[model samples]
Target: MHKILVVSDTHRKDENFYRVIDIEKDVNLIIHCGDTEGSETQMQQLSTAPMRIVKGNNDFFSNLPDEQEFEVWPHRFFVTHGHRYLVNMGSTDIRREALVRGADVVIYGHTHKPVAAEIDGIYVFNPGSLSYPRQEGRKPSYLILTIDDEGELTYEIKYLELF
Candidate 1:
């Protein structure tokens, strides 16, 4: 089985992000949708697992790509920060882009809102923001994606408890 950690919008704050890295120590891969705010290098080094990170709107000086595509056996993922795709409006634009890219999954962050759903056969996910969450509970959140031996995927959303 392959375990993956999906997180985004840290905005340079490492407290929660680092804590999560420590907690999910067994993750096989780490995917940062975007908005690391220049902490991409440190974030990558925090975990032994290979990381895939993209540039966010707040990352003015970052060198990361605007979008990335990769495959985990039968699943193809499209990763982006969501700003260019107008995520604030809805997922329509990004979904269209992902369809054009031939991806079965789309991971993104920008609205600082967590979303997990299947739309027209495409899996859409967002881990929200660890530094500044805007969801209903306003808790730092992330997604755990697990791919079993048969390539079946399962996902769960986790929230960090803060005092």
Candidate 2:
């Protein structure tokens, strides 16, 4: 089995964000959706594994890609920062891109709210913000996706309190 961690919108203020993640364990992949704030820089301080990332609207990652598309474990994923596609109102462009890329999952972060929806057999997920969260008046958050060697997949959006 593989455990994949997903985080976004860190905006960098929380020094404890890294503490909540046990990257040394059974984690097979890491995905960061952007706006890591200072967290991305701090995140860089510890190189755990190959990470997939995109630049958020407030993210300072100029070198990061505007859109990142990849396929893994027989599951294709498309990711973006969401601002360019106007994801807050729903992303038609991204949906199209996902179709074009033949993605089974579409991941993005920008609105700072956790969103999980499926459209036309395509699964779209937003891990929410690690430093900022909009729904349920809760603390920051992220997500965990699991895929077994047998090709079974499951995931959970984890809300984290990094105070």
TM-score (all chains, Cα) for each model: 0.97, 0.87
Candidate 1 residue-wise lDDT, 1-163, digit = tens? 8999999999988799888988886899999988888889987776669999999999999899999999997899999999999999999999999999999999999999999999999999998988899999899999999999999989998999997
Highest lDDT scorer: 1
Error of 2 at 79 (Å): 1.1
Predicted candidate 2 versus true structure: per-residue lDDT over 1-163, tens digit per residue: 7787877777765543565465335677788887764455557656365688788788664677777887778788898878887788886777888898889888988988887777897888888876668878766777788888887778787766544
Q: What does candidate 2 score on TM? A: 0.87
Those runs of model 2 whose alpha carbons end farther than 4 Å from true positions after fitting are 14-16, 38-41
Best by TM-score: 1
